[model samples]
Target: MSEILSAPAPQVGNAESWTRREILQQPETLRATQALLRARQAAIEAFLSPLLARNDLRIVLTGAGSSAFIGDSLAPWLSMVMGRSIEAIATTDIVSAPALHLRAGAPTLLVSFGRSGNSPESAAAVDLTEALVDSPHHLIITCNAEGDLARRAGANTHVVVLPDATHDRAFAMTSSFTAMMFAALSIFSGIATMEARAEVIAKALADTLMDADQRMAALVEHGFERVVYLGSGALKGLAREASLKLLELTAGALVTAFDTPLGFRHGPKSIVTDRTLIVVFVSNDPLTRRYDCDMIEELRAEARCGAVLAVSAQPMEGDALHIPHLEDAADADLLIPFILPAQLFGLHASLKLGLMPDTPSPSGTVNRVVQGVRIHAIGA
Candidate 1:
């Protein structure tokens, strides 16, 4: 087992910025999220009980950017456990074609994920759902209590506001992203209630953090022009989020891409270069692990990419970053902890590039929360 010890807070250095701080503080926020779920369990159950029992319920998980990726990460696992269909749609897509997404008069529940909860698309998606569908219920999971999505709470809408500290003062989301993902996992996955499985997630993160941090620092120091994150199933969603973190932090200085292990071999492999670092989030399931391992070996043999790494709980034949004590963890449970290293790499890479992790974008073109997004009126 490895130790992810909390060092004394520094006024300067890599941990100086709020983004890095948020990235480092994720384990604590996850623990806090556990407590938040325990506290709100009954009310959440009460609200969801009837909805879960419905034969005609339509649950759509929606958001934008990293927020949208949450639905991608959660939908597959949530759908299987509950034995129902769950759709992950980005708010950007919904706003563009509400008619395609929102079915009229369907018993719908819109789970909208946001860090600040103020993105124009967040509000527009909820409104579009109302305009085109029946009286739809809303589950707003966010860190900001005063943001538009949270304020939209009413008789038919329920909002779960996470810790304020997790709101992330940084321009790029770190803590908020994971915390909200934890919240959703806790709410939607029946397995989250099983103490043993929950322990797998918490303990794996505790042990892996420091080990991953040290390794990631070296990767950033070595430097790379492009990085690729790969995974399958629930982890594919994680890969997308991880890729976004790198792209956003470097302010386009470092190009990043993501795809499933099998999907990567199909043409997308062209993106790989001598300057590329390929990261695969290896699956725990034995069958899926075969494909993941095959990709790792194939990439290593090609010697085209600068480096190849795998994050896995399962024992591997080659050198890899192992998240200890989760050898038997289900793939869904692996999603949360699997992302920490990717997020840390983004932070370290951003800092190494001599950019502020808190404000990666020095110019005003991009923002902490998007600006100048025009939400249009929907009508006949």
Candidate 2:
């Protein structure tokens, strides 16, 4: 862990950019995040123990943009572990139509993820849940201690404010996203349970960061006009976040698409062209891996795309970036390491386009905390 902590930042674009620092500081941030969770284990359990006892408790994970994708990535895995159907609904969706997504009869737990925790929809969604649900508990996981979500702590709410460093200064999320996702996963899965696994996960992420920058930089040289990210199950959510990272960092300079490996064959495969770069996030599950590998082979066999790259924990045959020490890890653990290549590629691509990775959007159309969202009253 010291090696990762002391490793020099990758020389991508302006070395002093917050984007690069946030992206590179993940190894340290992850360790710090878990350590905080471990220290707060008693209080966390105190808050959650009684909630877990309810047979009819409805658990909903919500957020916006990159934050929303955190729930997308973890909902399925958490559902399996908790033995209940957990819902991953975006704050935007709930704020828009609370009736469709929330139930007033059921006792509910709303798990919200936010980096800045100031997004209009974030607080609005929580307000709507409190107004509509019969019995609602709030678990606000955010990087910002000063953000609105953290201030919502009360009798019915518990807030987990992450380390200040995770409150990303860059326009796009890198470490903030991973840290909040890890926090929610740790809280739900048991902090102590993750203690044994955290070191390997951090080490694997460090290895990927150390090894991926040059490769990602070279990949950016290809200048593919479009990119597609594919995965299965939990990895499918990761593919979505990966796609968003590229789109946001590149500022829409490169068209990007994301879908499950099997779903891509249905219609999305048509997006692949001679100038398209297709990257697959291969699953570690033996059954799911075969399907993911099949897609990789099929795309390669067709030879229509610019290139096909696989990011996998398992050893791959060709054209893949293999993450070390996670070959047998659960797909949930693979999420953080698996995202390194995409993050690096996004950073390098921004640098390649002469755009500041810290603020890729030149116009005021996009913002770090997001803008132009007006949270209307429920009946408005």
Candidate 3:
């Protein structure tokens, strides 16, 4: 196999490429997102105050693909914080079957995350919630201000726009995903303390990026044929996003699998091979971390996977991809930091395959924003 540089930086505004610059710029983008949210705290509070106080309120986090995963990471943490039931549903599913996911007469807050804000389902899901539920309010978090979602937002909607840079030019979502995920968490966690938490996280991420890029490059050079990602709780959603990142950038040239640490043994563990790379998201919880560490040792004993790497904030007795001070943060906060290494891996893996990280698929089968889907009239 030929050796190649993974995610070499791209000159801005040039048509030549994207992934490297966008992926590397994530920590800065997150800082900007936090500032943007902080500036709008008054408006956010005015809109959410009465609605949140309602005992019947239901929160549904909906988006498509990577966007939907934002909900997956947030739903578990936010539900615990807000003391309400929240669900992460894909807009693709909600647009297809609105009645099944939504209930009429429910006071609902539909939080939609979209990078371009123009996906057919972004708008369609909003319509479905409005039509199916008697009372529906919206909090639209998108990078694109000119796109459909931004344009269609009404009085019932409060739009939180991110920095224009997060509308990434790269085919894969990087900065956009992290920034939006952070924004959603801050919005629901009470905007007052967001600045303090974001400060700690942003600084930690900046330091991690400095250390992560080279380590990820070495992993890409290992020449693995397949990759498996394992995580528990909120981190599981991140594992799903990480798997999709590699699968997309490599154009399916590299096979991928994602599951909870315990869930892997049920049947998914069969995907492991000597040519495979295993990426584990080590949890902060003592009990959960035991399961995560157990899987790492189990796979190490089997000696099947090409290498086993642990991504943890704290180091135990041995080597791991330790992020700085992650153990002190809540499980919800770890979502942002844990995602960076996976993003770096995907960027490098694309180059390792001799594929353009910007647009790997020349056949037009997959696209930046999905195309060729004719929306069926579900009367949402």
Candidate 4:
């Protein structure tokens, strides 16, 4: 841990790319996010207390693209902690089939995550939930203070606008994803509980950022054509986000996949090739860590893929990225630090491909704020 703390500062990269800056700014942004949340805890709890008291309230986490993955990563852990089933429904799915997803009779609390808060599906999902649920409450978490979602504060709604730095300028989300994710995790799990853990998490993130660039850059030099991200429990959702980061930053030049380490054996394991790179997010839970280790060892022994890397808080035998001072931390706390290497890898991969990391797609098919989305009326 002392070695990690004393590590030299990150090597500077292309000055023009906001992607690298946003990726590297996570430690600071996350601390800022937690500080803001701490200051607002009284009011936030006042707003959420009544709704949480009700036994029938249904909590739904919704977002689109990377924002959506935040819910995917958090839902399971939060559900267990809160002692209730929490739904992680993507805004894309909610907008398309409101009737199918929304329960008219259930009291609902929609926790919406948006970096820009302007995604058509994000607004549409909130609208659909409001219209479809007889009793609906909204907790809008957004990085954009001026976004449509942030302006949604009302008697039944509360909006948390994160620090401006988290409103990432890059096409793909880096800081925004982790910041928003930390906010949601802190909110649902209790801000004070996370207050104790936040600095440790941030330090681990700083350490990971310090060591990640060169390691990920070296991996990019291998020119692996495919990448797979695997994890379990809360980490499974993280695996999905990691896969998306590589895919988006590389502009889909590299084929990517994500699944639980155990689930990968069922069928997804077939995607591996000698040109493939597989990364496993090793869990901190004793039982889950065993399974994660088993998969990591299995993949390495198979020798089918070009490389297998384990990202772990605890030491492992083979190729691994070790995160410091979080060996006893909850798996949820691991999410932010665990994602650093993947985000760095994506940036390095984009540069290696001769593409701009800030805006990977040359064609206007994808935008910083998504385009070509037409929100339609429910019945029309």
Candidate 5:
């Protein structure tokens, strides 16, 4: 008998309905965020208004898991575009070693990303930073309106809430990740205001959904046992997310792994077996694309997996086995579009594995906002 890995296929329209419903439900979060962002923009303006705006404004971008990847994606862009000092540090790291990530008596901004406001380390990081730093301003981005972080921004801090629908009921973060990311990008840069930029972003998202629905539908039909994801540069974060979405949404029925394109050659490539599904997130930058495409070609030549899929922002020169190219996706924002595809794949896998996409683990092994974490008061 053939091996069965994924859950049953969800009702055909279920994915589309969830997508639309989640987007509609997020308006309040989005609007409130607009207000919070404007306020943050004002506060930042005020803080810098007195002193000359320095390129050295230290920023620590943090979160756990998917939330951590949000920081990874934003840090480089903030550093290059805003020309500020930024680092993507996991709250776990700060919780373990505060001295390494913090500087005393320096003006620092802590941008914390959380889907549920209650991750233990998240609250702890804030407390630890306040305990150690001279002056720290916080910008909390979260999907849960009632989350501890969102409600606890206090008088001096800024809280930006994403769409309520972004609180992703599923085990994985589908809408929340993109919503929080866009909110951060909008806050730090004026990407939201540019008509052309908005158009491109919107188009990229639309195309991603339409194409992913078709491709993932077919992929899950194939029913592979294991999946390996690979990428480099900003795409590395995308690969991490893709790996998690597959693992989480499918409840680990499909074993998943991730590594940088070159990093995999060291030993991780051994994980690629005949039953594995290899998915590559190709880059848009010229230099990065060369490395990304080379790996895809190498994998195809080896044929180590049941299937090899490449999701790229642009078309590649050779005849490669992959899904459609996400055309005109010239920016890292292109990752936002690719996320829909991965999400669709996860959703389909969950259903194929006889799980519910809306609430996969009825046992409550996971939650929309994490539970069992307590908040403590730390003195300044």
Candidate 6:
């Protein structure tokens, strides 16, 4: 391991701390994540065994904010691997325009993600799906065991509670996002044995965790004024979460933006400057990775940005790339491994800027469940 790979891991919890201790320590969160995966698998096997057997089942993964992005990452892989049609739809849009998003009579499986599970939109979307669609089944994945969504799940719904620690105490979600994403991947892997997937997932996670433990301190110390995250295809949502992590963790001291690789050159590239830190999520797919590599190389040569970092699985052949993927590593779901870097980056940035990583927002401007938005009924 390089010097950058041996930094002290964040401590998880203690008696003195309320908010901050929750995420810095990993044991509880990791356990919770693993439990959530098991529960999700059980729920899917119980509810979806027969439905998935049918070819006409249309799977719709839905949520808001980080929750919504969980769907984006898993949709493509699940669609191809399981031979079922899957799409990620945002709950906000689903609430505002249910007819446009929901089909009238399709056998739809709406998989929802949430940290608190109490978000107004989450509940409303489920209600809307029932009203607008014929015979819909729901799979609710949430961190808050006592949340309304979990309580509302009846015989018709399959509800799985994520590990309690996944109900993050911080303003931004660190463990919850990755845990829910992993749960989604596990549920999709019903086509294969869960234990086999777990073996690969465990190896990938351990490696990333060890790498993040080392590199985070330096990335935070570099202290760029702004950060830009770039990804292509399904990764655009991960890019969004990565950008949001920095912004929220630092309480807006660090401005952030996200764009797809090809999308950036059109106009978003203007955001890159000497004080900006650019982090690119290289695609596993060869074609997409080529464009991602091209953009990073161009930026590195421009000397316009403070730093250009590639969080990649495959090593980039230069001094600039940060390769967390280990040699002889077992192949696993891509989303499982890529999330650790983003999680650690947010934690380090939060701590470096003197904001409590657990409670970045002391005044509660942003919250676990977003507040102050009234839910209005829409017309039929």
Give each model a TM-score. 0.94, 0.96, 0.94, 0.96, 0.83, 0.86
The lDDT for every candidate, in the order shown, is 0.85, 0.90, 0.86, 0.91, 0.70, 0.73
Candidate 5 all-Cα RMSD? 6.6
**Cα-lDDT of candidate 4:** 0.91
Question: Which stretches of candidate 3 lie above 4 Å from their native place?
Answer: 1-16
Model 3 lDDT tens row, 1-380: 10111344567555336787787677678788888888889999899888888999988999999999999978987888888889999999998888799989888999999999988888889987888889889999999988888776577899888988788888999889999999999888877787888877877787898679889999989899999999998899999999999898888999998999999999998898889999999888788889999999998888988999899977765447888866677877888888899988988888777888788786869999988767777653
Model 4 poorest ten-residue lDDT run: 1-10
Candidate with best TM-score: 2
lDDT of 6 at 70: 83
Distance from true location, Cα of 227 in model 2, Å: 0.7
Candidate 1 weakest ten by summed lDDT: 1-10
**lDDT digits (tens) for residues 1-380 of candidate 2:** 44534556446566337888888889889999999999899998999999989999999999999899989999999999889999999999999989899999999999999998999999999999999999999999999999999899688899999988888888889999999989988888889999978889989988888678888989899989999999899988899999999999989999999999999989998898899999999999999999998899999999999999999998888888989999899999999888888999999999889888888998868999888898788665
lDDT of 1 by residue, 274-345 (tens): 999999999988888889989999999989999999999876666689988888878878887898899889
* Model 5 pairs whose backbones collide: 6-352, 6-353, 7-351, 7-352, 7-353, 7-354, 8-351, 8-352, 8-354
Q: Say which prediction, candidate 1 or candidate 4, comes out ahead on lDDT.
A: 4
Writing each residue's lDDT as its tens digit, candidate 6 over 275-327 gives: 88888888777777899999889988889998888877777775343445433
What are the runs in model 2 whose C-alpha is more than 4 Å off?
1-16
The TM-score measured for candidate 1 stands at 0.94
How many steric overlaps does candidate 2 have? 0
